[model samples]
Target: MRNVILCVMGVALLSGCSWAKNVQSSKNRVYFENLYFPARLSTNSDDKQSFTVSVDRIDQGLAPAREAGRYEATKYCVATYGNSDVAWVAGPDAPDSELRIVEGRLQFEGRCDV
Candidate 1:
């Protein structure tokens, strides 16, 4: 009985984090909703456009979250610079955004190439 209850709780937790899955075109509308989901862009002292996107809970892992972050950063850069070109700068792992869970938070980093 205890094992069954634990399994149920685990499934419930995973279901609640369905947002962590890759944002498909059918769910593009959802991405828009996450626009201001602790995501922001800032110009560094060197004039580099830095960006960061974070999600509280990640289900599938960091790859999907990183992809979503990159997408959001690109959108932001396009809106701010009339172009969507961007270059990843740094992340919790490496410059290429490796899988690393930090305090139950998933984050991605990049820089706009405006």
Candidate 2:
């Protein structure tokens, strides 16, 4: 009797979930040319507007990594300050020689222009 009840509960739980659907929505998926690059944005403790974005796996491609970093920084500024204007200290528009890449990761620095 206990086994029968457990089996029914498990089936009920499984019915509510869809295995075919993507775990992450398209809106949240960050990718360049179907390749997903991991990016992280960190804000300064003393100044919330100042931020640094790091995108990993430069071995994949530099342009994509730069786009990923730009995307992350833009997302952060928009979310925090309700604006997209950014005063980049070191950003994507710079020439290749001016860009900073350390240990296979691209780095970007900026402050939200509110």
Candidate 3:
């Protein structure tokens, strides 16, 4: 019946919303929220050319999330040093977390090739 279909759809939608809420609360939302999406960059020394990038979750997909960290690092390198060349000294992959979700944090460290 039409009513039955409508009720089922409503329940599905509500459940989806609930799952999202649970996921949000289950992870380090507060920690991630404080950081910039894709990546957060900071210099490691007073030279101002050597930098590091700390990356948070990418909701699109896990693979993209991993690559986003690299992309972000490269972007930062180019912006700061006029070249996209960069070498990551740490963390292009997501480490294990309590939630076990498809989200993660990534980090990279290196100097601009300039």
Candidate 4:
């Protein structure tokens, strides 16, 4: 009798999962490599304080979103999104790749030391 009760309870629980369509998804993903230079950000009258950033080399970048945990330009294209900051940066002249995200868009000025 206990086993029968457990099986019915399990079926109820499994069927209830079908009603979970309202939940937001959490699997959004992006990747970048073979970087494009000078994202060529247009000027916004400087009154807005639009900043600039750099990426030094291909292998020096550290974008964790890539499928292999590295930017693969041919397969991935790194993008910047969210609050503007000096992010995804490496050192200059040392396997360095700098990236910045601002206002939900990415900027790639150029190779930092390449």
Q: What is the C-alpha RMSD of each candidate to the true structure, in Å?
A: 12.7, 3.0, 12.0, 12.2
Cα lDDT computed for each candidate against the true fold: 0.61, 0.88, 0.62, 0.34
Worst 10 contiguous positions by lDDT, candidate 1: 32-41
Residue-level lDDT of model 1, residues 14-99, one tens digit each, is: 97677456445345443423442233344556765776656544554445556556667777889888888877655533644454
lDDT of each residue in 1-114, candidate 2, tens digit only: 999999999987786564424454545778887788899999999999999999898889888888888889889888888999999999988999999988878999999999
TM of each candidate vs. truth? 0.49, 0.82, 0.48, 0.22
Which candidate comes out best when scored by TM-score?
2
* Candidate 4 lDDT tens digits, 1-114: 999999999999887775453332322223245443222222235422232332333343444222122222211222322222322332112232343444533443222111
TM-score of 4: 0.22
Off by over 4 Å in 3: 1-37, 58-60, 91-104
TM-score of model 3 relative to the true fold?
Answer: 0.48
Clash pairs (backbone) in predicted model 2? none
Collision pairs in model 4: 32-77, 32-78, 33-73, 34-73, 55-111, 55-112, 56-111, 56-112
Measured on C-alpha atoms, candidate 1 has an lDDT of 0.61
Per-residue C-alpha lDDT of model 3 across residues 37-93, encoded as one tens digit per residue = 555678866867677766665554545545656666677777767888765455455
- Candidate 2's TM-score reads 0.82
Evaluation by TM-score, superior candidate among 3 and 4: 3
